[model samples]
Target: MDIPAALGGVSTALTIVKQLNDIDRRVDEAGFKLRIAEATSALAEAKLGLVDAQEDIRSKEAEISSLRSLLKRKEETVERSGYRYRCDANKNPIGTALCPVCMDEGRFVLTIQSDQSGRPYVCPKCKANFGYLSAFQDP
Candidate 1:
């Protein structure tokens, strides 16, 4: 479930713990006279259960915090990397002068295709030969 739902569950657990503590005190004061030993034991057990529930809520909250941190980091990385755009011949950018491949703009098509990969690749759609950009060094 989402973070908000998990937080709500944690809140519910806290409320239950508070109620259990109140019950324990009431039972000790009133039920003690009727069944002193049994009431004491039951109250002790309920307190232990409440402690376990509290631990569960803490762990769930920690996990949500960790996930939020990871997402924030990924978003930062995408923002830093400028997109690569493709250009065509005549020094014009491809697809509205936008590099459809890397989504970068303001780049003219490299005069010659790169072949740094040492292998010829054909475009699957146009059957045209293209080289790897790594092979072409910036002039």
Candidate 2:
């Protein structure tokens, strides 16, 4: 009877040890899962930041393109504004000062056409009397 009781006690102790080992393993697995979750959250935040940075870059690029276009138009206007000139009797170019009224209105049209048979030259758009030539360089 004593031997049988000792064997029974040993079996119970072994069962308890097995239960403790299983509990320890479960705790270790839970800790690992928590670390994975934290890492995943960090990755998601980084991706969001990258997307914002890309959008900023795109907006700046578009603004730069618009400014470049405006600059080109301004340069063309400056080049055309030089040397006051007007049209001739046959709608041709000759050396004459451009009408101030037309130039002030952001236009380069010249008053060269003789509307009243040999009267004072008149501008087409503003009808100003003076040399108002067409804005185009060609005739």
Candidate 3:
């Protein structure tokens, strides 16, 4: 499956072909049969290498698609009133407030913990304290 092994297989096949071409009509039948078998084996190895390379390409493509989806979701999020929130398809903010510090660092959404009064208090994830916000209340 390694690229170098695949290239080596192709090189071996080519060498066999050249040798076969250079052989005179007086060459023994058994020796020619052996060379033909060797060439067949080399070609098979090269084919396997090509298959493995194709598989690797497909795997990488799938990973890229998944990452793009995550990035699109992240972009859909909104920051408001010193907090981060995920948005709906209509661009309306939804769910609990996320920690602004974690969001700024490009970390995963870490919901901010609030007091019983629904006021911004602290972040459970990053442990950031938002002390005594008299004006800011979670709705």
Candidate whose lDDT is highest: 3
Model 2, span 8-65: residue lDDT tens: 4445545554455555556587755554555455455555555666777788899789
| CA-lDDT, candidates in order | 0.42, 0.54, 0.73
> What TM-score does each of the candidates earn?
0.34, 0.38, 0.62
Best by TM-score: 3
Backbone clash pairs for candidate 3 read none
- lDDT ranking from best to worst? 3, 2, 1
lDDT, candidate 3, 1-139, per-residue tens:
3677789899999999889877663767777788889999999998899889888888989979977776776788766676656777665667666666776565655565466776666778788887643232334
Q: For model 2, which pairs clash?
A: 109-133, 110-132, 110-133, 111-131, 111-132, 111-133
Candidate 3 Cα misplacement greater than 4 A, ranges: 79-84, 87-139
Question: How many residue pairs clash per model?
Answer: 7, 6, 0
lDDT of 1 by residue, 16-101 (tens): 55555656665466643434454455555556666676787789899789767755533332211232223333433232111223
Task: List residue ranges in candidate 2 displaced over 4 A.
Answer: 1-27, 79-139
- What does candidate 3 score on TM? 0.62
